[model samples]
Target: MICKHRRYLMYISQNYSYAILRPIQKYILSQGGEVCWFLEGDEVDSSYLLTQETKLKTVKEVVDWKPDAVFVPGNTVPRFIPGVKVAVFHGFDSGKRSSKRGHFNIRGCFDLYCTQGPATTKPFQYLATKYGYFDVVETGWPTLDPLFEDNASNPYVDDNDKRPVILMCSTFSQSLSCAPTLFNKVKELSEKGRWRWLVQFHPKMPLEIVEKYKSLQNDNLQFIETDNVLPLLQMADVMLCDTSSVLIMFLLLGKPVVSFRNQSPSSYLIDVVDPSKIEGSIEKALTKPLEIESAINDYSKQVHPYQDGKSSARVVVATNELIENGLTNKRRKPLNLIRNFKLRKALKYWGC
Candidate 1:
């Protein structure tokens, strides 16, 4: 028979910390909470966030880990596990079958629900409530631990360089998805001799796209596809991106940015829990160009009010509470199994 309860089990919901959440994650570990990964190979840059510290054998690694509370962020299933849970709801896109493969492995998922904020998870909570009973909390953001780090005062990345670093945060613009176009854009910015561009792709993006970005081989351009997206902000002169959450993070850095309205199917931006007026409020910042900072200042304030560098700490506390409750209360069967099946099929399509 299975033990009614075990210790703490934390899994790798995503691969990297990039630069943003590293610090707060470090703080969480320091707080003496146990965390682990379903997969390994999260590269280490800063010591603040612990990576691969707890190695899990995936769902297949059942024997490898048995714990009282398990935290699943990033890629996960919503099965109703009797134990604790820390899950990040990706809003409607996740709620809707965002792909054709169908969902899978979401059974017995959360003892306590974790979302980006009250705003993002509110809709799901209503559904859960109507279904009868579900526990969800607006524990800030789970994956955004890196964004709240104290890299500098006012919680933003700034430098004294005349030529600023520009982060070209790209999304799946399949319509304009030709690698040559992205490469050319970087080359043009680099060749201008006035700016440096850092190209960071989403985890779901193809390696071939990243390879083409690397192939450009320009001195002024640095292209990276990694577990963490924080360093890109520190190195950014200005950010040009679509709807990635990293743009919200840039708000903490207090920099100017240009958001894209792409013509790609994948160009859709989720309702970022962190609000953005950056795209609209940007005034003559573009016209004057030299006034980028002021325009950046005016536009950036539109970010969601919750973007304090302390999000990771908030996450740790909320997750700990969920884990405690789950440990105390066991489930008779797995919950959210339907969602799991759909998600599994979807991951297979993505070759995950």
Candidate 2:
């Protein structure tokens, strides 16, 4: 059984975590639970905290608050915090790196991992069996809850001018990024006015590249910079991307994606190596061939099968269940002294 008025902490290290965790925050608040924001690193902007939202400024405050659970969207969380540490994840597995370095990297920081779907759940379940330290729960992803909601508004709806809206996004990894390679081609297509274009980049995207795209904004193209990309994802008809996890979110919407040099090119994506073929690929995706559509549906189900917009609720329930059952049967969490020390030094929390 879950507590009715539980206290939760939103441990934020990166700005994008705001979009990832806010849906969960709303669900917590609606359940008569209290949520506090703990802004840890410089990547997070405190100004994003709303007036109604409470912000815990110091590690001492977080300790004193004694949250029932600390919801972490980033990779690691301070073990010193007085709560069950939960890993909600920041994004999908974009196959940008090896399993050891990327999504499946278990840092021994979390007690519960609320995975998106089977694609991640199966691997995490294997790790749970091997480690016996944490629990894996397929509660979908809170960030995607709004995507499936009924009342989500599309601000770009009126601007499409009957043209197929193409959202262009890329990863920040220098080796994997297609922004620089596809810039000239994207600019040329945007100028032709054949389709509407909306371009959003990773926050870590180089300043020069962001500026170049910003300068290209016109009647045909618009460059958006926001902590939340859900609106842009919903507004666009088709997405043109690289290996960015945002493409996975777009695919979950049952939309077709055209990628440039994706790390793992599958049937679901219309991936092209040559920049010249991007336009043709986008045209093909717009047509939505039966085979590609079927593949996208199959892939989406594996990545995130939930489309009810209730993932946040499931996450809350999963945390409660873990707390109620306790971790008595599991083995001790590895003493990750180095990572813990780094977290302690970063948060300046030396408490035992």
Distance from true location, Cα of 335 in model 1, Å: 4.3
Measure candidate 2: CA RMSD.
1.3
**Per-residue C-alpha lDDT of model 1 across residues 115-214, encoded as one tens digit per residue:** 5544446654664454434466665654455445544542224355356566776555464232434355556556766665567776656677777778
Question: Top lDDT: which candidate number?
Answer: 2
Per-residue lDDT of 300 in model 2: 89
Indicate the TM-score of model 2. Answer: 0.97
Go through the candidates in order and give the clash count of each: 48, 0
Candidate 2 structure quality by residue, lDDT tens digits, 1-352: 4546789999998888899999999988887889999998787888878889899999999999999999999888887888999999989999999999999999989999999999999999999998899998999999999988754456767732988899999988899999999989999999999999999999999999999999999999999888889988888889999999999999998899999999999999999999989888888988989999999999988999999999999999989888788873379998888988988987788886
Pairs that collide in candidate 2 are: none
Go through the candidates in order and give each one's C-alpha lDDT. 0.49, 0.90
- TM-score of predicted structure 1: 0.65
lDDT at position 184, candidate 1: 54
